[model samples]
Target: MSEIIRFYSVTDDYGEFSNFAEYPVTLKKVRWPTSEHYFQSQKFKDKKDQQEIRKANSPMLAARMGRDRKRKLRRDWESAKVNVMREAVFAKFTQHEELRELLLSTGDAKIVEHTENDDYWGDGGDGRGKNMLGRVLMDVRQALRDDA
Candidate 1:
């Protein structure tokens, strides 16, 4: 169910269609030469190696390397914390179907916002603070569902 296009190769010595005229061509079958191929050629290989060595020793490479290391460390720390929190929540709610239903039903339930003075947790502490525990519990439930 696809349409095909016909292509003819042009040559200065013999005009158009002198090389290829009776063939259909598709984009997928085309082999386009790019800059990477030119650089890989024998004539430019040594120059390319020298340029790469200069780039590797530049201050820009050092800064990029430092930023990459910091990014990797932050990613690893976040992943570790997420895994620990997920495991803790799962352990606490094991075999508790009612609590699972309540949590899942929150998707459709109305979320009522409270004033900053309201003490919803009833622990005489600031209830307006972020609910880290609830966030971890939701994340754990989502992780379990994803595995299933």
Candidate 2:
């Protein structure tokens, strides 16, 4: 059995992100990419919106977009949103100093999605698999130490 360690998590209708702390800190500015980032990175999930995204990405034309990108985003918000959320949460931890510090203080802390079977990210590693988020956090911790 893996060593029993303290892990933090939040739960609701969506799911959970474990191995985090219950720190009373909020981000000053959320410098994280959103589902909008997925829309921007990939394209519209709706078949009808594909043409618009294609046109927008065309070399001859630029996608004139407002803050929210209007209807040029993925319509299926309930499907396969974990990847987007992962990026966002990771960004949140990395961009904010308070959160980063809080996270680093928790040595070997991890982030696991309660509802998903993500071996690459969730609790697949009982000291034997990849914990991508934890690895990143530790990397940041190392960087911070180096900076100090």
Candidate with top TM-score is 2
Per-residue lDDT of model 2, residues 26-145, tens digit only: 222321122223223333555445434333432113223312366565566535444554554555555557666665565544433322344554445454445554454456556666
State the C-alpha lDDT per candidate.
0.32, 0.41
RMSD each, Å:
28.3, 11.3
Off by over 4 Å in 1: 1-83, 108-130
Cα lDDT over the full model 2:
0.41
Residue 92's C-alpha lDDT in candidate 1? 34
Which regions of candidate 2 are displaced past 4 Å? 1-91, 107-116, 125-128
